[model samples]
Target: MPDPAGQPPPSSHTLWRAFVPRWAYMPLSGEGAARFGGRWNPVGQPTIYAARELSTAWAEYNQGFVQHPALIAQLRLDAARLVDLTDPAELDARRIDPSIHACEWRDAMDRGKVPETHRLRKRLMGEGADGVIYPSFMSPGGTCVALWRWNAPGALRLTVVDPDHRLPKTQASWV
Candidate 1:
Protein backbone atom coordinates (compact mmCIF):
# COMPACT_ATOMS: atom_id res chain seq x y z
CA MET A 1 0.00 0.00 0.00
CA PRO A 2 1.51 3.30 -1.10
CA ASP A 3 0.91 6.17 1.30
CA PRO A 4 0.68 9.23 -0.87
CA ALA A 5 -0.49 11.43 1.99
CA GLY A 6 2.18 9.83 4.20
CA GLN A 7 -0.43 8.53 6.62
CA PRO A 8 -0.95 4.87 7.39
CA PRO A 9 -4.39 3.43 7.99
CA PRO A 10 -5.70 3.36 11.54
CA SER A 11 -6.07 -0.43 11.47
CA SER A 12 -7.46 -3.47 9.70
CA HIS A 13 -10.98 -4.75 10.24
CA THR A 14 -13.18 -7.76 9.53
CA LEU A 15 -16.84 -7.54 8.64
CA TRP A 16 -19.75 -9.84 7.95
CA ARG A 17 -22.58 -9.83 5.43
CA ALA A 18 -25.30 -12.16 4.27
CA PHE A 19 -26.54 -12.51 0.73
CA VAL A 20 -28.64 -14.85 -1.34
CA PRO A 21 -26.82 -18.01 -2.26
CA ARG A 22 -27.20 -17.20 -5.94
CA TRP A 23 -25.15 -14.05 -5.47
CA ALA A 24 -22.48 -15.63 -3.35
CA TYR A 25 -19.97 -15.56 -6.18
CA MET A 26 -20.28 -11.80 -6.30
CA PRO A 27 -20.30 -10.94 -2.66
CA LEU A 28 -18.47 -7.72 -3.39
CA SER A 29 -20.97 -6.53 -5.95
CA GLY A 30 -23.30 -3.68 -5.00
CA GLU A 31 -25.47 -3.59 -8.09
CA GLY A 32 -28.55 -4.76 -6.21
CA ALA A 33 -28.23 -1.97 -3.68
CA ALA A 34 -27.47 0.47 -6.46
CA ARG A 35 -30.66 -0.28 -8.36
CA PHE A 36 -32.93 0.03 -5.33
CA GLY A 37 -30.81 2.34 -3.16
CA GLY A 38 -30.24 1.81 0.54
CA ARG A 39 -30.07 3.76 3.76
CA TRP A 40 -26.46 4.67 3.02
CA ASN A 41 -26.70 5.14 -0.76
CA PRO A 42 -29.04 6.76 -3.16
CA VAL A 43 -30.21 5.08 -6.32
CA GLY A 44 -27.35 4.55 -8.81
CA GLN A 45 -24.59 4.78 -6.21
CA PRO A 46 -23.43 1.28 -5.46
CA THR A 47 -22.60 0.48 -1.84
CA ILE A 48 -21.55 -2.67 -0.02
CA TYR A 49 -22.99 -3.03 3.49
CA ALA A 50 -21.39 -5.11 6.19
CA ALA A 51 -21.50 -5.59 9.93
CA ARG A 52 -18.78 -5.78 12.56
CA GLU A 53 -20.30 -8.92 14.02
CA LEU A 54 -21.91 -12.03 12.61
CA SER A 55 -25.02 -11.72 14.74
CA THR A 56 -25.46 -8.22 13.55
CA ALA A 57 -25.16 -9.39 9.97
CA TRP A 58 -28.00 -11.83 10.53
CA ALA A 59 -30.11 -9.18 12.15
CA GLU A 60 -29.53 -6.82 9.25
CA TYR A 61 -30.37 -9.47 6.73
CA ASN A 62 -33.49 -10.73 8.41
CA GLN A 63 -34.96 -7.34 9.25
CA GLY A 64 -37.89 -8.95 11.10
CA PHE A 65 -39.26 -10.76 8.08
CA VAL A 66 -38.80 -14.31 6.94
CA GLN A 67 -36.10 -14.41 4.33
CA HIS A 68 -34.81 -17.01 1.95
CA PRO A 69 -31.73 -19.02 2.75
CA ALA A 70 -28.63 -16.86 2.76
CA LEU A 71 -24.89 -17.23 2.42
CA ILE A 72 -23.11 -15.50 5.26
CA ALA A 73 -19.60 -14.29 4.50
CA GLN A 74 -16.77 -12.90 6.53
CA LEU A 75 -15.03 -10.04 4.80
CA ARG A 76 -11.59 -8.56 5.35
CA LEU A 77 -10.74 -4.91 5.02
CA ASP A 78 -7.13 -3.75 4.89
CA ALA A 79 -5.92 -0.24 5.57
CA ALA A 80 -9.29 1.17 4.66
CA ARG A 81 -10.11 4.82 5.09
CA LEU A 82 -13.43 4.97 6.88
CA VAL A 83 -15.21 7.64 8.85
CA ASP A 84 -16.87 6.53 12.04
CA LEU A 85 -20.22 8.24 12.07
CA THR A 86 -20.89 6.90 15.55
CA ASP A 87 -18.02 8.87 16.97
CA PRO A 88 -19.36 11.86 18.88
CA ALA A 89 -16.10 13.77 18.54
CA GLU A 90 -16.02 13.33 14.79
CA LEU A 91 -19.70 14.22 14.51
CA ASP A 92 -19.17 17.35 16.60
CA ALA A 93 -16.03 18.30 14.67
CA ARG A 94 -17.88 17.82 11.39
CA ARG A 95 -20.86 19.79 12.70
CA ILE A 96 -23.17 16.85 12.04
CA ASP A 97 -26.03 16.09 14.37
CA PRO A 98 -26.46 12.60 15.79
CA SER A 99 -30.11 12.54 14.72
CA ILE A 100 -28.92 11.46 11.28
CA HIS A 101 -28.53 7.97 12.65
CA ALA A 102 -32.30 7.78 12.83
CA CYS A 103 -32.92 9.24 9.40
CA GLU A 104 -35.85 7.69 7.56
CA TRP A 105 -34.16 7.42 4.21
CA ARG A 106 -36.63 5.01 2.67
CA ASP A 107 -39.60 7.13 3.58
CA ALA A 108 -37.88 10.21 2.25
CA MET A 109 -37.14 8.48 -1.01
CA ASP A 110 -40.74 7.32 -1.28
CA ARG A 111 -41.82 10.93 -0.86
CA GLY A 112 -39.58 11.94 -3.77
CA LYS A 113 -37.13 13.72 -1.50
CA VAL A 114 -33.41 13.04 -1.07
CA PRO A 115 -32.66 11.44 2.22
CA GLU A 116 -30.43 13.19 4.73
CA THR A 117 -28.31 10.05 4.91
CA HIS A 118 -27.72 10.26 1.18
CA ARG A 119 -26.58 13.82 1.51
CA LEU A 120 -24.26 12.86 4.34
CA ARG A 121 -22.72 10.14 2.21
CA LYS A 122 -22.15 12.55 -0.65
CA ARG A 123 -20.45 15.05 1.62
CA LEU A 124 -18.13 12.48 3.17
CA MET A 125 -17.38 10.96 -0.21
CA GLY A 126 -16.42 14.35 -1.60
CA GLU A 127 -14.03 14.68 1.35
CA GLY A 128 -12.19 11.53 0.13
CA ALA A 129 -13.65 9.08 2.58
CA ASP A 130 -13.98 5.53 1.31
CA GLY A 131 -16.91 4.68 3.53
CA VAL A 132 -18.54 5.10 6.92
CA ILE A 133 -19.14 3.16 10.14
CA TYR A 134 -22.35 3.84 11.98
CA PRO A 135 -24.49 2.26 14.63
CA SER A 136 -26.91 -0.22 13.12
CA PHE A 137 -30.60 0.44 13.53
CA MET A 138 -31.51 -3.21 13.23
CA SER A 139 -29.05 -4.35 15.86
CA PRO A 140 -28.55 -2.36 19.01
CA GLY A 141 -24.95 -1.56 19.83
CA GLY A 142 -23.93 -3.05 16.50
CA THR A 143 -21.78 -1.22 13.97
CA CYS A 144 -22.00 -1.38 10.20
CA VAL A 145 -19.87 -0.18 7.33
CA ALA A 146 -20.98 1.07 3.97
CA LEU A 147 -18.23 0.98 1.36
CA TRP A 148 -18.43 2.58 -2.05
CA ARG A 149 -14.95 1.74 -3.29
CA TRP A 150 -12.51 -1.06 -2.64
CA ASN A 151 -9.88 -3.40 -4.16
CA ALA A 152 -8.56 -0.68 -6.43
CA PRO A 153 -5.73 1.74 -6.59
CA GLY A 154 -6.00 4.78 -4.29
CA ALA A 155 -8.53 2.74 -2.27
CA LEU A 156 -8.58 -0.03 0.26
CA ARG A 157 -8.58 -3.80 -0.27
CA LEU A 158 -11.58 -5.97 0.60
CA THR A 159 -11.72 -9.75 0.23
CA VAL A 160 -14.10 -12.55 1.00
CA VAL A 161 -13.24 -15.21 3.59
CA ASP A 162 -13.27 -18.28 1.43
CA PRO A 163 -10.03 -20.15 2.16
CA ASP A 164 -10.56 -23.52 0.45
CA HIS A 165 -12.15 -22.57 -2.84
CA ARG A 166 -15.55 -23.38 -1.47
CA LEU A 167 -17.38 -20.50 -3.09
CA PRO A 168 -18.11 -21.00 -6.74
CA LYS A 169 -16.22 -18.71 -9.08
CA THR A 170 -18.40 -18.81 -12.19
CA GLN A 171 -21.66 -16.96 -12.68
CA ALA A 172 -23.22 -20.30 -13.48
CA SER A 173 -23.59 -20.63 -9.75
CA TRP A 174 -26.38 -18.15 -10.07
CA VAL A 175 -28.44 -20.46 -12.19
Candidate 2:
Protein backbone atom coordinates (compact mmCIF):
# COMPACT_ATOMS: atom_id res chain seq x y z
CA MET A 1 0.00 0.00 0.00
CA PRO A 2 1.07 3.55 -0.65
CA ASP A 3 1.88 5.86 2.23
CA PRO A 4 -0.43 8.66 3.34
CA ALA A 5 0.93 10.74 0.50
CA GLY A 6 0.13 7.95 -1.97
CA GLN A 7 3.83 7.30 -2.49
CA PRO A 8 5.65 4.06 -1.84
CA PRO A 9 7.01 4.20 1.68
CA PRO A 10 10.47 5.69 1.87
CA SER A 11 13.25 3.11 1.71
CA SER A 12 16.04 2.99 4.24
CA HIS A 13 17.84 -0.27 3.49
CA THR A 14 17.30 -0.91 -0.23
CA LEU A 15 20.47 -0.59 -2.26
CA TRP A 16 20.54 1.87 -5.15
CA ARG A 17 22.66 2.12 -8.26
CA ALA A 18 23.57 5.60 -9.42
CA PHE A 19 25.30 5.99 -12.77
CA VAL A 20 27.52 8.98 -12.28
CA PRO A 21 29.13 10.66 -15.23
CA ARG A 22 32.78 11.28 -14.60
CA TRP A 23 32.03 14.98 -14.40
CA ALA A 24 29.26 14.52 -11.83
CA TYR A 25 31.19 12.61 -9.15
CA MET A 26 32.76 15.60 -7.34
CA PRO A 27 29.45 17.40 -7.26
CA LEU A 28 27.51 14.38 -5.93
CA SER A 29 26.44 14.99 -2.36
CA GLY A 30 24.66 12.61 -0.01
CA GLU A 31 24.96 10.94 3.39
CA GLY A 32 26.78 8.00 1.81
CA ALA A 33 29.39 10.19 0.18
CA ALA A 34 29.75 12.09 3.42
CA ARG A 35 30.13 8.87 5.39
CA PHE A 36 31.95 6.58 2.98
CA GLY A 37 33.66 9.23 0.87
CA GLY A 38 33.83 9.18 -2.94
CA ARG A 39 34.73 5.64 -3.89
CA TRP A 40 34.53 6.28 -7.61
CA ASN A 41 37.55 8.51 -8.23
CA PRO A 42 36.62 9.59 -11.75
CA VAL A 43 38.65 7.08 -13.67
CA GLY A 44 36.94 6.51 -17.03
CA GLN A 45 34.54 9.49 -17.20
CA PRO A 46 31.44 7.30 -16.64
CA THR A 47 30.85 4.78 -13.86
CA ILE A 48 28.14 3.21 -11.72
CA TYR A 49 28.14 3.69 -7.94
CA ALA A 50 26.06 1.74 -5.46
CA ALA A 51 24.56 4.19 -3.03
CA ARG A 52 23.80 2.88 0.45
CA GLU A 53 20.05 3.41 0.33
CA LEU A 54 17.26 5.61 -0.89
CA SER A 55 17.44 9.13 0.50
CA THR A 56 15.65 12.35 -0.29
CA ALA A 57 19.11 13.81 -0.63
CA TRP A 58 19.87 11.33 -3.39
CA ALA A 59 16.90 12.63 -5.38
CA GLU A 60 18.85 12.33 -8.61
CA TYR A 61 19.57 8.60 -8.23
CA ASN A 62 16.17 7.00 -8.85
CA GLN A 63 16.89 5.25 -12.16
CA GLY A 64 18.31 1.72 -12.42
CA PHE A 65 21.94 1.49 -13.38
CA VAL A 66 23.67 -1.13 -15.49
CA GLN A 67 26.09 -3.49 -13.80
CA HIS A 68 29.72 -2.40 -13.65
CA PRO A 69 32.99 -4.19 -12.96
CA ALA A 70 34.73 -1.83 -10.56
CA LEU A 71 31.76 -0.62 -8.48
CA ILE A 72 30.85 -2.30 -5.23
CA ALA A 73 27.20 -2.53 -4.16
CA GLN A 74 24.96 -3.70 -1.35
CA LEU A 75 21.17 -3.97 -0.81
CA ARG A 76 19.53 -2.31 2.16
CA LEU A 77 16.88 -4.50 3.80
CA ASP A 78 15.54 -1.89 6.23
CA ALA A 79 13.85 0.14 3.52
CA ALA A 80 12.45 -2.76 1.55
CA ARG A 81 8.83 -2.43 0.40
CA LEU A 82 6.39 -5.19 1.18
CA VAL A 83 4.31 -6.50 -1.71
CA ASP A 84 0.80 -5.05 -1.70
CA LEU A 85 -1.59 -7.87 -2.50
CA THR A 86 -4.55 -7.03 -0.33
CA ASP A 87 -6.66 -7.71 -3.40
CA PRO A 88 -5.88 -10.77 -5.51
CA ALA A 89 -9.49 -10.74 -6.70
CA GLU A 90 -8.62 -7.92 -9.04
CA LEU A 91 -5.97 -9.99 -10.77
CA ASP A 92 -8.22 -13.07 -11.07
CA ALA A 93 -10.77 -11.08 -13.00
CA ARG A 94 -8.13 -9.92 -15.41
CA ARG A 95 -4.82 -11.50 -16.54
CA ILE A 96 -5.24 -15.30 -16.36
CA ASP A 97 -5.03 -17.05 -19.70
CA PRO A 98 -8.62 -17.90 -20.60
CA SER A 99 -7.70 -21.29 -22.02
CA ILE A 100 -6.78 -22.90 -18.69
CA HIS A 101 -8.81 -21.94 -15.59
CA ALA A 102 -9.85 -25.53 -14.86
CA CYS A 103 -8.29 -28.93 -14.22
CA GLU A 104 -8.84 -29.81 -17.88
CA TRP A 105 -5.57 -28.10 -18.71
CA ARG A 106 -3.73 -30.31 -16.26
CA ASP A 107 -5.55 -33.38 -17.48
CA ALA A 108 -4.63 -32.51 -21.04
CA MET A 109 -1.02 -32.15 -20.05
CA ASP A 110 -1.10 -35.55 -18.38
CA ARG A 111 -2.46 -37.02 -21.62
CA GLY A 112 0.20 -35.37 -23.77
CA LYS A 113 -2.22 -32.86 -25.25
CA VAL A 114 0.27 -30.12 -26.02
CA PRO A 115 -0.59 -27.45 -28.54
CA GLU A 116 1.50 -26.20 -31.39
CA THR A 117 1.38 -22.41 -31.02
CA HIS A 118 1.46 -21.64 -27.28
CA ARG A 119 2.00 -24.07 -24.44
CA LEU A 120 -0.49 -24.20 -21.59
CA ARG A 121 1.27 -24.78 -18.31
CA LYS A 122 0.67 -24.49 -14.59
CA ARG A 123 1.01 -20.99 -13.06
CA LEU A 124 3.76 -20.16 -10.63
CA MET A 125 4.34 -17.30 -8.20
CA GLY A 126 7.74 -15.70 -8.13
CA GLU A 127 9.77 -15.28 -4.95
CA GLY A 128 9.30 -11.53 -4.49
CA ALA A 129 7.25 -8.44 -5.44
CA ASP A 130 7.04 -9.51 -9.05
CA GLY A 131 5.37 -12.64 -7.77
CA VAL A 132 2.58 -10.71 -6.13
CA ILE A 133 1.73 -9.04 -9.40
CA TYR A 134 2.85 -11.43 -12.12
CA PRO A 135 2.71 -14.83 -10.35
CA SER A 136 3.66 -16.78 -13.43
CA PHE A 137 6.95 -18.49 -14.20
CA MET A 138 6.11 -18.93 -17.90
CA SER A 139 6.76 -15.25 -18.47
CA PRO A 140 9.25 -13.02 -16.69
CA GLY A 141 7.65 -9.70 -17.73
CA GLY A 142 4.59 -10.67 -15.64
CA THR A 143 0.83 -11.06 -15.91
CA CYS A 144 -1.92 -9.51 -13.83
CA VAL A 145 -3.46 -12.94 -13.23
CA ALA A 146 -2.35 -15.37 -10.55
CA LEU A 147 -3.35 -18.88 -9.60
CA TRP A 148 -2.65 -18.86 -5.88
CA ARG A 149 -1.93 -22.56 -5.45
CA TRP A 150 -1.02 -22.29 -1.80
CA ASN A 151 -1.31 -19.89 1.06
CA ALA A 152 0.56 -19.72 4.35
CA PRO A 153 -1.61 -21.09 7.12
CA GLY A 154 -2.09 -17.90 9.13
CA ALA A 155 -0.18 -15.00 7.61
CA LEU A 156 1.47 -13.75 4.47
CA ARG A 157 4.99 -12.47 4.02
CA LEU A 158 6.13 -10.77 0.82
CA THR A 159 9.45 -9.23 -0.17
CA VAL A 160 10.02 -6.18 -2.30
CA VAL A 161 12.30 -6.58 -5.29
CA ASP A 162 11.72 -3.60 -7.53
CA PRO A 163 10.14 -0.20 -6.94
CA ASP A 164 9.06 0.59 -10.46
CA HIS A 165 5.53 -0.29 -11.50
CA ARG A 166 5.38 -3.38 -13.72
CA LEU A 167 2.31 -3.40 -15.94
CA PRO A 168 0.16 -6.52 -15.90
CA LYS A 169 -0.32 -8.50 -19.10
CA THR A 170 -3.90 -7.31 -19.42
CA GLN A 171 -2.90 -3.67 -19.55
CA ALA A 172 0.36 -4.22 -21.39
CA SER A 173 0.91 -5.41 -24.94
CA TRP A 174 3.41 -8.22 -25.37
CA VAL A 175 4.76 -9.30 -28.72
Candidate 3:
Protein backbone atom coordinates (compact mmCIF):
# COMPACT_ATOMS: atom_id res chain seq x y z
CA MET A 1 0.00 0.00 0.00
CA PRO A 2 1.10 3.58 -0.65
CA ASP A 3 1.83 6.10 2.07
CA PRO A 4 -0.59 8.94 2.74
CA ALA A 5 1.14 11.04 0.11
CA GLY A 6 0.88 7.96 -2.16
CA GLN A 7 4.44 6.81 -1.58
CA PRO A 8 6.02 3.73 -0.02
CA PRO A 9 7.22 3.54 3.57
CA PRO A 10 10.52 4.97 4.78
CA SER A 11 13.59 2.82 5.24
CA SER A 12 17.19 3.28 6.36
CA HIS A 13 18.32 3.57 2.75
CA THR A 14 15.69 6.22 2.04
CA LEU A 15 16.54 8.11 5.21
CA TRP A 16 20.23 8.18 4.38
CA ARG A 17 19.90 8.98 0.67
CA ALA A 18 17.13 11.54 1.16
CA PHE A 19 17.76 13.02 4.60
CA VAL A 20 21.24 12.63 6.10
CA PRO A 21 23.19 14.48 3.41
CA ARG A 22 20.62 17.23 3.54
CA TRP A 23 20.51 17.26 7.33
CA ALA A 24 20.76 21.04 7.34
CA TYR A 25 17.70 21.40 5.07
CA MET A 26 19.02 24.40 3.19
CA PRO A 27 16.72 26.51 1.09
CA LEU A 28 17.03 26.40 -2.67
CA SER A 29 17.34 29.16 -5.36
CA GLY A 30 17.81 32.05 -2.95
CA GLU A 31 20.64 34.20 -1.64
CA GLY A 32 19.64 33.23 1.88
CA ALA A 33 21.10 31.02 4.59
CA ALA A 34 20.05 29.65 7.92
CA ARG A 35 20.54 32.11 10.79
CA PHE A 36 23.01 31.07 13.43
CA GLY A 37 25.12 32.90 16.11
CA GLY A 38 23.17 36.12 15.43
CA ARG A 39 25.15 36.61 12.20
CA TRP A 40 24.80 35.37 8.68
CA ASN A 41 27.71 33.85 6.86
CA PRO A 42 27.64 32.95 3.19
CA VAL A 43 25.06 30.25 2.40
CA GLY A 44 27.48 27.36 2.76
CA GLN A 45 29.91 28.36 5.52
CA PRO A 46 27.52 29.77 8.09
CA THR A 47 24.97 27.03 7.56
CA ILE A 48 27.60 24.34 8.01
CA TYR A 49 28.82 25.95 11.21
CA ALA A 50 25.26 26.43 12.39
CA ALA A 51 24.51 22.80 11.61
CA ARG A 52 27.43 21.73 13.74
CA GLU A 53 26.29 23.98 16.55
CA LEU A 54 22.73 22.78 16.20
CA SER A 55 23.92 19.20 16.35
CA THR A 56 25.89 19.91 19.46
CA ALA A 57 23.02 21.78 21.05
CA TRP A 58 20.67 19.01 20.07
CA ALA A 59 22.98 16.48 21.60
CA GLU A 60 23.30 18.49 24.80
CA TYR A 61 19.58 18.98 25.13
CA ASN A 62 18.77 15.38 24.40
CA GLN A 63 21.77 13.88 26.21
CA GLY A 64 22.95 12.27 22.96
CA PHE A 65 23.04 12.91 19.22
CA VAL A 66 21.47 9.56 18.38
CA GLN A 67 17.73 8.99 18.60
CA HIS A 68 16.60 12.52 19.38
CA PRO A 69 12.84 12.35 18.98
CA ALA A 70 12.31 15.99 18.06
CA LEU A 71 15.11 15.96 15.51
CA ILE A 72 13.84 12.69 14.11
CA ALA A 73 10.34 14.13 13.77
CA GLN A 74 11.65 17.23 12.09
CA LEU A 75 13.78 15.15 9.76
CA ARG A 76 10.81 12.98 8.88
CA LEU A 77 8.72 16.02 8.08
CA ASP A 78 11.47 17.56 6.02
CA ALA A 79 12.07 14.31 4.20
CA ALA A 80 8.37 14.09 3.38
CA ARG A 81 8.49 17.52 1.80
CA LEU A 82 11.63 16.60 -0.07
CA VAL A 83 10.12 13.41 -1.52
CA ASP A 84 6.60 14.91 -1.96
CA LEU A 85 4.46 12.37 -0.05
CA THR A 86 2.25 14.77 1.95
CA ASP A 87 -0.85 12.55 1.81
CA PRO A 88 -2.84 10.43 4.27
CA ALA A 89 -3.48 6.66 3.99
CA GLU A 90 -4.41 3.42 5.75
CA LEU A 91 -1.51 1.13 6.62
CA ASP A 92 -2.17 -2.19 8.32
CA ALA A 93 -5.73 -0.85 8.39
CA ARG A 94 -4.77 2.24 10.43
CA ARG A 95 -5.13 5.78 9.10
CA ILE A 96 -2.18 8.14 8.88
CA ASP A 97 -1.84 11.77 7.82
CA PRO A 98 -0.23 13.13 4.66
CA SER A 99 3.16 13.98 6.04
CA ILE A 100 3.74 10.48 7.38
CA HIS A 101 2.21 8.88 4.29
CA ALA A 102 4.28 11.00 1.94
CA CYS A 103 7.40 9.74 3.61
CA GLU A 104 6.28 6.20 3.08
CA TRP A 105 5.27 6.71 -0.56
CA ARG A 106 8.60 8.36 -1.31
CA ASP A 107 10.47 5.40 0.06
CA ALA A 108 8.37 3.06 -2.02
CA MET A 109 8.65 5.03 -5.25
CA ASP A 110 12.35 5.47 -4.80
CA ARG A 111 12.85 1.74 -4.40
CA GLY A 112 10.05 0.33 -6.51
CA LYS A 113 8.48 2.05 -9.54
CA VAL A 114 10.55 2.96 -12.52
CA PRO A 115 9.84 6.54 -13.61
CA GLU A 116 6.79 6.88 -15.85
CA THR A 117 7.07 8.13 -19.42
CA HIS A 118 3.74 9.94 -19.40
CA ARG A 119 3.85 13.72 -18.89
CA LEU A 120 1.24 13.64 -16.15
CA ARG A 121 3.31 11.15 -14.22
CA LYS A 122 6.20 13.58 -14.11
CA ARG A 123 3.88 16.39 -13.00
CA LEU A 124 2.14 14.40 -10.27
CA MET A 125 5.40 13.00 -8.87
CA GLY A 126 6.98 16.42 -8.93
CA GLU A 127 4.01 18.03 -7.19
CA GLY A 128 4.37 15.90 -4.06
CA ALA A 129 1.80 13.27 -4.94
CA ASP A 130 -1.32 15.43 -4.69
CA GLY A 131 -2.23 14.84 -8.32
CA VAL A 132 -4.20 11.84 -9.45
CA ILE A 133 -3.07 9.05 -11.76
CA TYR A 134 -5.64 7.04 -13.73
CA PRO A 135 -6.50 6.26 -17.30
CA SER A 136 -7.95 9.19 -19.18
CA PHE A 137 -9.46 10.21 -22.50
CA MET A 138 -8.65 13.31 -24.49
CA SER A 139 -11.06 16.19 -24.96
CA PRO A 140 -11.08 19.37 -26.95
CA GLY A 141 -8.59 22.04 -25.75
CA GLY A 142 -6.36 19.13 -24.63
CA THR A 143 -8.03 18.18 -21.37
CA CYS A 144 -7.84 14.69 -19.89
CA VAL A 145 -10.98 12.81 -18.87
CA ALA A 146 -9.68 10.47 -16.21
CA LEU A 147 -11.35 7.25 -15.14
CA TRP A 148 -10.66 6.14 -11.59
CA ARG A 149 -10.39 2.45 -10.82
CA TRP A 150 -11.92 1.80 -7.43
CA ASN A 151 -11.16 -1.28 -5.38
CA ALA A 152 -14.12 -3.61 -5.60
CA PRO A 153 -14.90 -7.22 -6.33
CA GLY A 154 -15.36 -7.82 -10.06
CA ALA A 155 -15.47 -4.13 -10.82
CA LEU A 156 -16.41 -3.26 -14.36
CA ARG A 157 -13.56 -1.86 -16.38
CA LEU A 158 -14.25 1.44 -18.10
CA THR A 159 -12.30 2.68 -21.09
CA VAL A 160 -12.24 6.11 -22.66
CA VAL A 161 -11.67 6.42 -26.39
CA ASP A 162 -10.74 9.89 -27.56
CA PRO A 163 -11.22 10.66 -31.23
CA ASP A 164 -9.55 14.04 -30.92
CA HIS A 165 -5.77 14.11 -30.72
CA ARG A 166 -5.00 16.25 -27.67
CA LEU A 167 -1.68 16.66 -25.95
CA PRO A 168 -1.53 15.80 -22.25
CA LYS A 169 -0.43 18.71 -20.10
CA THR A 170 2.70 18.12 -18.07
CA GLN A 171 2.15 20.98 -15.64
CA ALA A 172 2.22 20.23 -11.96
CA SER A 173 -0.67 21.52 -9.83
CA TRP A 174 1.50 21.87 -6.74
CA VAL A 175 5.08 23.01 -6.84
Candidate No. with top lDDT: 1
Give candidate 2's error at residue 27 in angstroms: 8.9
TM-score-sorted candidate list, best first? 1, 2, 3
Instruction: Score each candidate by Cα lDDT.
Output: 0.85, 0.29, 0.25
The 10 consecutive residues of candidate 3 with the worst lDDT sum are 12-21
Question: Model 3: per-residue lDDT, tens digit, 64-116?
Answer: 33654432211111112112122232323324232321233333434554322
Task: Show pairs that collide, candidate 1.
Answer: none
Ranking by lDDT: 1, 2, 3
RMSD of 3: 21.5
Model 3 residue 13 CA deviation (Å) reads 38
Cα misplacement distance, residue 97 of candidate 1 (Å): 0.4
Per-residue lDDT, model 1, residue 6, is: 24
Clash counts for the predictions, in order: 0, 5, 12
Residue 39 displacement (Å), model 2 = 26
lDDT of 1 at 67: 72
Question: What is the TM-score of each predicted model, taking all chains together?
Answer: 0.92, 0.19, 0.16
Writing each residue's lDDT as its tens digit, candidate 2 over 68-173 gives 3222123233333332232354334324343332224334434555431112111212222212222222223222211121123432322224345331224123
